[model samples]
Target: MAFADACNWINGNVNSNLTNRNSIQAICYSDVKSQFGLTANHVVRACARVAANRLTAKRKRRKVREFKPTSFDCDARTFRIIEEGYLVSLSTTEKRIKVPMRVSNYHIGKLQGRPSTSAQVCKHRDGNFYIHIQLKSDAPKLKKSKNVIGVDFGRRDIAVTSTGNSWSGKDISSIRDKYFRTRTSLQKKASQGTRSTRRRAREILKRLSGGEKRYQSWLNHNISSSIIREAIATDSIVAVEDLTGIRERTNQKPRNKTERRRSNSWAFYQLRAFLEYKGIKEGVKVIAIPPSYTSQTCQKCLHIGTRNNKSFKCENCGNNCDADYNGAKMIELWGCSVNQPRGSELLSCDINSRATESLHLPYRKCR
Candidate 1:
């Protein structure tokens, strides 16, 4: 925008020397108007953009810098600079974000990723300042292998992969149960009496719920990260179940009628979304197959209908395996076989492609 005009110079000049918030620099607003005769506002905007870009690049794990027009051979010689559309302030060094928020510059110079025509920004609830830059490009993903991984979706356990790997859905389940119990108890107490103490209890419960939501957000991040990491280690395509029609297919106990409305809630959708993005980043392909009979099939012999007890033994194959692993394997097979729709029990939005919506994951909603 108007502020983006001076970025060309700022890209080279933005450093510890330029940012003297207390002590004005030689090239302040007056200098921009007098020296280059540029918009006084534009100079600062460009400077901030440059600063933000520098900081963001420094922080990046791969350190991919914005695509400088001068650095590449392209048919397009230059990109237009956007006004106060989007901008940020980044650390001159140390790869840190020194600014909590900044304006946006739509103009084009050099950018690190996919370029956008609109403004973008990111804010942190964590107290740390961040230079928000929306990289239009996504992190590159690794190639997916043909190998199928069995995944078991459990109620008590979060998820157990066919390869004997497991991660706690503990955090997720705890949040779900904790929220249910505390919220229910508080409401009951309030209903029993309209005392001030009950009112305070209700407020406390509300805060507790916020905490629970935050925990779940973090939990989903952890689970997705773990799943992607595991997939990377094995170099196999993660096979998940086609969860389509899972709701009508199974019975789940809820706390009460109201809470049942959020039955699927945030956990399941978060896991899948995280996995999808992670898969793209890591270059792993995720596959979905029919979820039917995955739990009943024996991993050892691929025998079906052998589950007679909690500790499953293949009736036809004589294979003894952990019931969890068997379930995960079934999910993997279903993931590899076909695409399924999400179950009716899932209340959250399914962000997956039409094909992946019902694909089962190794994780279970520990509700």
Candidate 2:
């Protein structure tokens, strides 16, 4: 109740111009304490959280919505790990309470000696509460290598590497289609069925929600782990396309209903995120290169080529190969260039030019 009140207070007071923590606390500290009866520590943390959220939304150019009380932030002063790491003491509006956490071997190992200064108390939809402890540690030095492995992402083949490794998206696509049909049927029944049938349908729909997303996440984790292991084995840098704004850019073009759904459902960003964090933990260098024309350029001759479906053929060099594999090779070359001192200058192509059918010149190294 106290957490919810504090969040609501912060949400009501926060705005575009007054998102600074110190400034907001200066203005609303007295009001928060008096109105919500939150402790000074809770008030401070709530104000800081709202400010942080606003800053993130601003960076992403997203709208600031009213904050929900699903979670609350805590600091060292408000929370502490106790009972030899099995219990956590949390400060609440009523009083300080010690809660015993369900411990796993993995959790014990991770929290054995780490200093956790902050945490967030979250309420899961499953009606259970969980605390996320933030542990800080020094990052390992990145592995340096001249060898580069590029990964190309697409709907047909989820990920293809320069080393000829590929994960086909056929199974995933079929599973998604099945889920889509099931959801459509359930939604119709939920709206039009008899009372008992509608109730059952709604319950099933609720249970089915997030099933596909969880599967996608699990698959991405496996794929990223494999790619990172490959990079570690060969001592190579991992290079992927900088797909920022890709969905928005592609959505502008006309497409059929199924195509649009598949395109929107692609979890390439999550895969990239997994690769990045896993790389950081494993000390691998994961970098992003220009994505424009990667699939249409020939790795053998560095010339713009004709791509048909899954095949790419370079007229200039007469090089023919799998389109995704060729793109991965070109990405590897681009990654090599990016690693060099004057690499950016060598990649002088107009990246903003979205002309796909036009005859654009290829990238060339400076003499």
Clashing pairs for predicted structure model 2, backbone only: none
List model 1 lDDT by residue over 1-367, tens digit each: 2233344444444453343422233445465555555443334444445555555666674432443322111011111222344343332212323232343354234352445432322234565434323335566655645565665655556668877887756556666776888888888886785688788887777667577777777876876687778888877777655566555444365357544534555355456666777788778776655666777766555555556555788655467877877788666655544333442222123233532553456976786
lDDT by residue (56-116, candidate 2, tens digit) is: 8888999666777788889989999874759999988879999999989999988887889
**How much lDDT does each candidate structure score?**
0.55, 0.89
Task: Report the error of model 2 at residue 301, Å.
Answer: 3.8
Report each candidate's C-alpha RMSD, comma-separated, in the order given.
16.8, 6.6
TM-score to true structure, per model: 0.54, 0.79
Distance (Å) between predicted and true CA of 234, model 1? 2.8
Query: How close to the true structure is residue 285 of candidate 2, measured as C-alpha lDDT?
Result: 94
Model 1 segments more than 4 A misplaced: 1-132, 138-144, 170-175, 251-266, 306-309, 333-367
Worst 10 residues of 1 by lDDT: 70-79
